[model samples]
Target chain A: MIRDTIRPGTILRVLVLVALIAFLVAPERFAGLLAPLTTNNAPPIYNQGSLVDLTLSHLFTVAISTLAAAVVAVSLAVFVTRPAGREFLALSRAVVNIGQTFPPVAVLALSVPAMGFGEAPTRMALFLYGLLPIFENTLVGLSTLPPAVVEAASAMGMTGRQRLLKVELPLAMPLILEGLRLSAVIGLATATIGSTVAAKGLGEVIIAGLLSNNLAFIVQGGVITGVLAVLISDGFQAVARQAAKKSGTRPQTET
Target chain B: MTMLADAGPDEPAASWRIDRLGVVIALLLVVALALPFATFRATRIASGTGLLLHEALPAPAAAAAAAALVAALAGAVTLRRPALRLAAGVLALVALALGVGAAAAFLTPADNPYARIAPGSGFWVGVFAAAMLVTDAMVRLRLGPAGRLIALAMTAALIAALLASGAWSRLSLLAEYRSRADVFWREANTHVILAAGSLAAAVAVGLPLGILAHRVRRLRDPMINVLNVIQTIPSMALFGILIAPLGWIAANVPGAHALGIRGIGMAPAFLALFLYSLLPMVANTIVGLNGVSRAVVDAARGMGLTGLQRLFQVEMPLALPVILTGIRIVLVQNIGLATVAALIGGGGFGVFLFQGLGQTATDLILLGALPPVALAFAAAVVLDAVIEISGRGKP
Candidate 1:
């Protein structure tokens, strides 16, 4: 029965690995077929930078914003859960809700002028855009602990600080990790759009393709970005799974 | 807090005291009363336009002070439950109306017809603070979904009445829209078409895939991963990628080329948006279907019902709410993402948005950005109501 089951995930992984290796070892040999994807009067294939460099920049942009968002969101979540900070919970929630509601494009457009056209504005937009999911997830993680568990911790003479660090946070690790994963995955896609504001990433190739009507550049850019996003998401999902296993808590998938 | 606990029996002071949210209202009011309400600009663009000496017209200081006083009075209301709720709601609404009035009054003083008065930092902050205060009071009132809707409707009606009164005829955003009314309406129609078309396409593709994934255990993981991967591709990159294959097909295939599937335009934009919408729809459908109780399924089968009959009669009704929730997310998401289509010459409000960015015109950007936001928000609210109603109908 087990052998009868064709594991599509394994096959997909192997296929993707082979494709990545082929692309890296011989870019022309692998992605060369895409070169013909051009219309009449289209510009030559984008040669300003290699795929490897663009991938690095794309990952860099997404990573920085995701990290920044995670730090800020997790810290804010922790703060609002504290006794003195509890009153500000609704206010914080409202702020994050507004952040979620504002589209990334609007944020990018609004930010570009003040911050200038580069990774700075892109990072800012990504950070703001990614805050809500992480914050809300962390809030849910921290707040949903069983009352009896908390009472027991208090009864056992644990200090407030110790209880938070040793008990509550560890129990909430899987959920918090899930939030970070969500943020990182979202950041991956949003970072590409940053190219419109002159931020260096895979999006520049795509934008270049659009402007020049060159299918090759678009295909190449899209493939690299799509692959990177998949890999990044898989990596995060694996980490979340490990975290869940360690903490003995099933990770909730629904937002 | 301690004082309330320690109050003398003779003094019913606790019943007549202002709370923390009220204090925020008072503080914001004080800030507004002290600062300038708005700034007046000379032209739309041009850092150093001809003979330009930009004027920073002062606010209608008296009207602002009056608004602040009203806000403070609202915050101080401690008349106990029902009375307190009513008084605070009225006061917050009054404060909001006055804030708008103050802004209007600020614009009226601009004698130059060409002058544009932008809401100043003080006015913006005051309005936000007042809104937060009102939201807090609404929370205190413990309003249900229906009550909240009524409150929102009332606020909208009030704003419309204000607009009818010509209270904001000189507002910068409205003026920008007025100048491009024809183009704006056209773009708005295009945006709606793009959003709705993509949503319909997504539902068509996603619904069956979701069911297939749910039924086949092995297909579920890989299928979901593929959808998730698709979602992660930046919208711009996705649109870019589609242009190549789509453009190629349009060129080579006689049928496709005739159907308006060009390299850049609505085709690629719609395709990209359709891809983006699939994930949530598929995920939600699977979740909804899977959530149906095993016992209910057993009961349905025990009744000698066929697979299709059981699914239609029992499972679908139960899953409808979850499915609708998915549709809601997709609809709202598509609305926002459709704005990106403008980058590829796909007509939408994004024309104004990108143009505004290119020109560094904040008001113009707002003109494009606000409608999509309002659309997404309205879509979400309506969908939530649908989900709620569907949920309530289930046995």
Candidate 2:
């Protein structure tokens, strides 16, 4: 199972991590290094707030929305797949399609009128935007179950509920997780837009940079968000592979 | 457990009295009947938003809606025939129109010159319910491609006729559009240009990288991983990231500023969109090429076809449809995403969106938001047609 012991990717990733840590721990040291990118000695650090605060807020917004999206999407998928809820499948599909088609920025704009500003509208927009991927994957996962396995479960006199809970869900968990991973990554990126609506996240740093034409601020925000997204996405892929291994199936490398 | 097994197939029927669809329809009706249809605002963009205003429907509209809702409810409860379902769907659409018309007529009081009205939650619920009904009916009809196309064309024609009749002239969103029609068109053009430019770049870069990744196995994962990482960078952050390096290039390089590759504006916006689009395009190309059946490749080899010949004649033809599908996804995504380019002074309908946000003008925001959604949908449909044609050619 062991592949390359010393991957170029690994080296690049470590270098990035060290650089990021250095940037956060002692940003002033990089001031001289980034001076060329600045306009006539503009401050090299993003002074709006600490990078730590921005990162924490960014992660928090993404986490809340992604978790909410996953729960709702998975539940809706499960509901529609169930025999009693099958009649609503077309309607559910329509709902998700609407959600997917409507851009998140539009959602944010429309929602601001009703929900006001700050975190609430942003959360609502993020939650709606994240629904489609998770719902689609969960539907695929649940529907693609082996008929033989279901029959075998029934042959053991397992209840309908038990078969769904124990067999179908477990088998489908990996795909569902893939959906979650996608939603989270997307949420991670989209959450930055929340700053426009004054929701206080990493986007503030980026926006501030844009307004002031400060390259240092821009890079600082971009690097943090970029690194966080990459790490989270990779982490999710590893977890998905682990789930596939436990499920006793050859991992499908969709990611 | 035995009892559960015995009752499994029967349970669904026993509990199918109304079904989830019926519940949705019922809920929609209940909400429509209870809530306000519109909110009247004193000015275009003010914080002291007034109370939700309920207006009584005209007698004919009220009767029409009641009858339509009744028919829809009856259809939901008892109908199984496709024709009947379609009728119910049409009825729901009528109800929706009547409801909206009633709200539109009452939005600005006859004597009030400075007031604007926005659709309230109940109006949205009714619209969604009608849309769902129509979609469900379409599913029930199981129309072929031609039928669906005709339906779409007919709907478009109807909408065009309505616009021509100036039915929406009084609408706040339309009012907003009318005030700055030239700028609206300009923004729309810019939006299209940005999306198209980025899409072209994405294809140019992605196709080569995808081929290289496919050819060299070791390069596949890391390249794909890098692109995926690029995709996960927020659009704003990605745009921000491009600012510094591009600025440096523009500032330091000779004659680069003249070429317009600056920190802000179209340069950074296009670069960011291109970066975001790479993963889908590249991944699709790889998937398409790899999907070329091994048996067919073997046959090509056995026939003494050269590597390039086999790739062009065998793999390329087979992969074209999937590759196009990838392009469709990327194009649609870019259209939606290009709205953010407005933030960086890249120009687009997002100009209206941000302005609307700043001014607290909902109609102005919608003026920007609606076009990109429409554009994306159009791209999806047209690309789907292309995919269908290519697939048919294969067979």
Candidate 3:
């Protein structure tokens, strides 16, 4: 279609593409995405290798943590969406809202006492915050299932669990995926807080730049973080769109 | 009016019930009159506030009179059928007002045993709480969208009032009261003003970009996808990244420093803040635009409106509520994240927020934190009220 080639959001696409291209070639303009491992005494927060590994592991943590949250959120949503479970739905929603409202930095500080200042606590915090979108969307998706299809399945002798797994879950998958996409995006952003609590991530590079007052290092960190955020969020959105197409549903990611 | 018009056109009913409201009003007035008499050291209060308002009277007598006034106002709390939850609210205001008029330190000597609840402090709380409740209620009852716009006007008024009335001089608890008021004001108000500015700048830049992309289908997804990605970057780390580059620009650029560009001040902190608000604004704008009906657009085009005209006349209006919602979200969020900008010395209300955390001075932090939280919530509610008033354009 004519709309496909010159979409309304064209400039945004070009700009983002350029940013991505420039970022991928970053190693060519520089040695790598990180500064050297050094021991200059100041606010020297993290070394170089940790920075590299931190970025990689942080992504993994986000992916896995979000995946875990997705499972819990979706199932909770399904269970709570049942006719007998309306109260649970309201309760879970309130819980999710409070979880998101409880600031991440506050969580980081508090988690230090129990989780001992590292990736574990940061992951826990991200997982907790990610629930808002996923849980909210799952309930929405499950509730929106077409009645005719559900009745037809039930009329054919599908058990309660059978109908949920076969018909309801499939019907709700697209909306559920949208929730996951939002969670994935939020989870990736929040991963930066890990640095303050001694959790490894791209934030280490940022913290490093701050301590040394090095402009290049700061750009390196910001560019990399931006690039990562863009890539992962886009990937999740793509999957969500694909799921929406398969299910033949409206595409919506905004909550 | 349809149910949506909100207020019951019952002003005559409201006025007629003033007699019913009289118990609260009278009680509050009496309490204000009597407080100086009951204050810990009546001798000092007689000289303190009685020197002015009731110069003819003694402190104990004044304090007793004020207490009596307050007890009467307290009766308003006894009313039922909270009626849009305003009855409980009005009673709260009257009690607070009378309490302040009676107990404020302005009317009692510093050493007065009962000076703990100074008349000055009480009056501020009483008046503010009363004003807030009544103002909010009136807005809902009568003004609608106009109410929200006026709320912002009111917040500005409150700020001015705080400054003019020298209320800033009295905004401290007993434990923290002796500290510098100017310092606290600077540390608090500056952050809020800066946060608002940053969010505004973000919306300014983001809206046009979003509109452009929304009109360009090919550009929309990729651009939004990138914005989506950029948004996922942690705010704290993003701040860390801007310091060096922005600091360099500040040091090197001519007159940049003169333009309020400190290494870690408004510019870089704003750059970080701006970037953070981008995704939501851009995405929401695009989504809102996309959500607009194609048939209506075609009709606008058919009705002889040019593309630009349609954008302004049709699309923009329809998309506005959604775009504003996005703006509201970003604005509220940036206010919170702006607190972190203090880490880089960007000098916003966050200065106190972060310090409160670092020093564990909940009092100091509360001084910083409560205002912005209150401001953001009020803004959100007012905006919702505005959307409610905007009426069927699609929020």
Candidate 4:
């Protein structure tokens, strides 16, 4: 069963990696292939910046923001779920849930006024945008641990801290990672919008394409971003499945 | 069971002992004191000077605002009753709103059309904290759907009254709204139509497709997988990707232009939103249907009901709440995404947002941004109430 799932995922990962590499390393090579899509003598490939640099920066922005969001959200989740902090649970949950309704683009726009343009606002936006899913998932993961298992931990004389670190966390790792997976996917997609505010990313490529009416650049940027999101999402799923299997828990079905 | 017994005796006392409202009030007080109360700009779109509360408002008003905030904080810490805490929160919110408006009015020169005043970080943070306090109190009070709706209505009316009073007329956001009120309403209309129209389309199509997926086991995975792939694509990239093919169609297809099907306009934007709406709609429908109790379905079968009748009478009614949950999700999601539609000339609140971005006009951006947030929030609450009411009606 493990092999059945892992094999297809591995093949897909390989395929996507190759395509991403081709786009970054030799984007011009695809220019001839894309020429049919362009009109008005528009350049078939985006030339203002190397695709490699754009992709790296996009990944970097997503990485930094998602990391920051994970740290804060996971910690906040832990804080509220603890007995001492249980009183604040409803308030925290409301904040997390309601925060999700704000469109990420709007958040990005709002940040620009406060932080000024460039990567700062984008990162802030991504960080804020990434919080809800991770926080909610962490809360779910921690709270939903089977009561029997918890009792067993207590019965075995495990200290509260030890039980959390050793048993509960391990059991909840899959769902927690699922949350991280969601945050990362969302960050990756949202980071593209950061380009509009002069943040460097794959969105730069797309926006460039749109401004010039270059079909090729649009396709290149769109394909690369879509593939990147899919691959990362798949990778997260594979890891989550592995974690769930190790912990003897069922992997959550995708919504 | 042992664990429950272990915690049961002291849990209620422990939970009620701590005043969580105190934390929110403390945060509010800190925010009120620490950040700028308002920003005074020389002209619209120019960087503003942040003014502390003392500097922004007249001495008496500033002192009064400070006194109100301190009182709220004290009340939060000392008050044992939820009602008192709730009142304190409302008082703090009102004081902050009026204080910010007063600051705007005070800071703006009487004859300067170019000068603008905006609420600074302090005001925004205080508002958030006050709102949190109110929400926390409401949750603790265990207000039902009707109570919550009443609260929402009261809040809306308060805001309307504030706006009508012209207390915030000097605020840059209001100035931006005043100048482009016509454009604002038009874009607001566009935004709602884009969100609601797409949702309607998704429901019309997704319901049958969802039913088909439920009936045909083989088609389910592929259908979901395709939608997932579509969902994975970034909205900006997806919007850009649609332009090429759509533009080609518009140019070549004879009636396409006449039908308002073009590369960069509502067509692509509407289509993209429609596409994004489908997954939640279909997935929820399937999940809701699958959630129907097997025994109940069997009982319906035993009653000589056909498969179609069983589905309609037994399955769908049971699934309505879950399906409505899906609709809620799509509606909120579409409302947010519709803002991005402005990028392609789809003309929604995003028009103001992107325009504000281009001009570095903060108030213009807020004008574009706030409505959709309000709309999505309102939709979520209303639909949640609907879902709850429907769920309660279930047998």
Candidate 5:
């Protein structure tokens, strides 16, 4: 269905998200993934081993937050995207959009009071704000099931849940997975916002270095986080593609 | 038509429960309004004044509670008829006016009722009154799903109004909320313009990038990836990064003074907010473009359409939903990120937030945060309406 999404699109996407996540989970992996002979000025500090510990925490937080986000998001998607639920669909999505659109930094900043300081509030903010993508995608994927396939499933005596689990979900898996992939990457990137709240993450390094004018620290931090996001995003995308391929489903949008 | 016969079974109990819940919520609100009126005590109203922050009830806050009771009952009773709803809403507002006049009837400085009614518990009671009144009117207007939704929506609005009005009193820093109705309108207007500008910039930047990536396969990944990175950087850090370079440019650039560059005005703030917004705009564009079906493209081409012609006519038109999707995303994000711009000499709504943070003033932060939020909701509704009107890519 992707009309103009550019070519080698997958690889750039892989690099984009993989690079970010690698910086977090396996900085060593990220360093090795780089093409080695880079001419870019900012490459060296990214390859260095200075930010391993900090990157780990950021990765861990994002991973947890993404998982937490998935439950709420998928449920919300189910609620809002149903035909009967359409009235509120736009509104719910809009709410999610607002949540995400607000700068993660703003969420953390606004949250300090009442919610008080620490990782708990940051996590709460991240979870609340980061639910849009997956929610939107999951709803789209589930709702747009081809009539023929759904009819066939019902004709074959499949139960409603079975049809959903077997036919619809599989068919929609690719796009849904893509949404998750992007959401995961976005979540990881925004996790840096948590640093402002004094939550432990690579953001702390980035924020501290930027404020303190410690270019080396900034370089190290940015590179590591960027690599981490890329790697994880790539992995999700690969899984998405595999899922799509397994389903042998035609893309929606036949003219 | 055949698929309709094979439609999946729904959870009867679940659907029933939701309907019940909606009605239940509406009833609870109605009950709350009426019940409180019975238990309500008619204590004497209070009067006092100092800073906006220092206003308190001259008499016990019980009187304010009594007013809340009256406002709620009045709201509940007046909302039965469409015409009456508006009239009652207006009448209660007038009663509120009289209450204020009575409270502050004497000398106006240390004895102003404006502070007492608008501050602390008075402000809270006022919120309850406003909520009851507005919710009552909304129910009569026949807005769907509002019974349950309005409760939450009204609460949020009330909280935000409380904070905004606090700032408007101008007794604080970061953002001085001017309490006069005219000043309030001005601040609200500023927020609207800020939101509009943000959406405009995002749409302008995103649409082209989406088209470019769609046309050039190799460009897609890199474009989307760049957006992803843009999204990841926290606004605070982004601002921190932007300040040094931007401030340097503003300070050194020749003829900058003629450009309305005040060393730290809107320039750096816009840049920071703009950078952070790249993710949704770019990502939505990529997603939408990718989603255009091959069959449609092939059909256009087979019909003898040139590459450019098909790209513009078939492809972009078909891709409008996805494009709108991006717009929606960018618009929402812009509203929120606009606030963060206030932190570093950037102007928008964040001044209230940071000021509140610094001074422990919830009201100030709320003021800065509210208008953008309200605007986002308004924009979302308008965009959806446009999307519906166009019938873009919908089955």
Candidate 6:
């Protein structure tokens, strides 16, 4: 089993992970590799703060905002789909659809006016911006469940609450996870822009680089962010796939 | 897909029913009435005191505006006809716009260049509620594409008339626009170029690549995966990543500087946007082409049409709607991303946005932010209509 787990894909993933960790811990160690690209005397490694801490802060912001968004969006989706709350469905859909057209950067910039410069506004922007995909997917997931399965739950004398918690939620879990994944990916990207608002994140490194004309810092920030986005997205996809398999549902193909 | 398709069963016309959505709008309007209508600042960037509606407007005008709000709330509950509801909503919107202008004018001390009056949270909430009212009424009316376009035109005309009348002259947003009118237009042009130019380039390259991926079965997944990876990179990071390599090329390669290739500015911004746009463009093309019925292609082939001829004359037409959908996505996405190009001196609306951010000037930020949003929204609507029209003529 151990040997079977040591496939090429796993090896590649492990190597990438190791490289990311090494880069974060001692970016200066790679300064020689990047020296050819830098013309100025400015340090090649971003030294204002540790890249590891910035990465953690970035992940924390994304996680907190995505969690808040998932909670609120899932509840909103649940409410709108319920018979008693169905009257507000159109309004909710309109809000979600229109909200998405506003870019994350624009939203982040706009939030600074109301919330001032800090992680607070950043989190708020991410939460609001992340609401769409998760809400939309949860709506789709819950509504598209096989009617017979719901009927079978009903026929088995399952109460509405029980049916929702036990039957409906389990079946909807994979798509909900997929939605969360998209929201998280978006939040991670947008959080980089939050540094402009004085929020601590990887964006600080990139902005510092941009201001100082330091190519090394820019590359460090950009490459790490890009890698994090891809890895987190892939991680979520893997989890979603697992959920789908366990639920006996076919995994949804990425659009 | 039809989850929100007017699920409520029809009721008798004589019966009274509470519009639940109307209730929400009415609540929002109430909240709007209670909050500050505008802010009065001694200078453009200074913090200001919030002014309530009654304080911001003359007594009679304030009373009239208050009455209109009450009427709108009542109408929301009692109005049964869609036509009447739409008319009421539009009237309320017009009143709200005029009220905002009036508040700005009243609050600003005449002949004082330093005084600035900006619309506050209440004004925004009122606008939101009024917009929702208008949109809900329109959706209920089930207006056709032409009617919707006409509605958009009328709204635009109303705004143009307001601007021409100088009703919003005292507003700080208008002041920001006036001061940098030339720069605003220039940046606006650059923004359009960044978005449209990148999209055009993406289509030029993505289309053929998409067709190639479709034809070459083994290439599809890898091609899509590569593009997806590109898409995964945040716009800021991607822009940063491109700067060094492009800079090196511009420095080492002769004539690259003359060709306008640089590490920063439009070159990298454009390249980044072009790279970002490829996935949607290419993916949509593949999906659209694959969706074309094999039977239809076979029929075209039986008619002695060559492969290229079949692709153009038959498959392309059938696939056009989906391809257009891709274009819509790319256009909207690029419009938003173009604002980020301002970071690297790409010269778009983001210049105003970032400048506003640095200065903490809300009106400047609004000036920068609002146009791109309006553009993206307008593009989505127009493309959606186009897609629908194209699809309508199909089987």
Which of the numbered candidates is closest to the native, going by highest TM-score?
6
- lDDT (tens digit, per residue) of candidate 2 on A114-168: 6878889888888888888899788878888989998999999999999989898
Off by over 4 Å in 6: A1-7, B1-14
Q: What tier of docking accuracy does candidate 2 attain?
A: acceptable
True-contact fraction in model 1 equals 0.42
What C-alpha lDDT values do all the predictions have? 0.72, 0.76, 0.60, 0.85, 0.55, 0.86
Candidate 6 has what TM-score?
0.96
User: RMSD in angstroms, all models?
Assistant: 6.0, 4.7, 11.0, 3.3, 9.7, 2.1
**What DockQ was computed for model 6?**
0.55
- In candidate 2, what are the lDDT values of residues B204-312, reduced to their tens digit? 9988888888889999987987788788877888888888778879988999999998988989999899898899889999998898889999999999999999988
- Let me know the TM-score candidate 2 reaches against the reference structure: 0.90
lDDT of 5 by residue, B172-194 (tens): 22123544346456545555566
Q: Higher DockQ: candidate 2 or 6? A: 6
Better of 2 and 3 by TM-score: 2
lDDT by residue for model 4 (B266-333), tens: 98899999998999989988999989989999999999999999999999999999899999989988
Tell me what fraction of the real C-alpha contacts between chains A and B each candidate also makes: 0.42, 0.55, 0.26, 0.55, 0.15, 0.52
What's the TM-score of every candidate structure?
A: 0.85, 0.90, 0.64, 0.95, 0.61, 0.96
What lDDT is reached at residue A17 by model 3?
64
As for candidate 6, its interface RMSD to one decimal place is 2.9
Q: What lDDT tens digits, residue by residue, belong to model 3 across residues B156-176? A: 675566446553333233224
TM-score of chain B taken alone, candidate 5: 0.62
- Displacement of residue B128 (Cα, Å) in model 5 is 12
Model 1 per-residue lDDT tens digits across residues B180-290:
999999999999999999999888899889888889989988788777878877777788778777877898898997888998899999999998899988998899999
Worst lDDT run of 10 residues, candidate 4 chain A, spans: A1-10
Give the Å shift of residue B389 in candidate 5: 4.9
Candidate 1 local distance difference test against the native: 0.72
Tens-place lDDT per residue, model 5, A77-173, is 7665555664344335434443444555455555664376667767776676667678867876887778888899999999977987788778878
Candidate that would win on lDDT = 6
Model 6 over residues B1-395: C-alpha lDDT tens digits?
11112223333455778878788888998999999988999999999899998999999989998889878877877786878777777777777789989999888786788889998888888888888887667666666666767777887898999999999888899998999999999999999999999999999999999899989999998899889889989888999999988998999999999999999999999999999999998898899999998899999999999999998999888989889988988998899989989988898999999899889999898888898988887787777667777888676
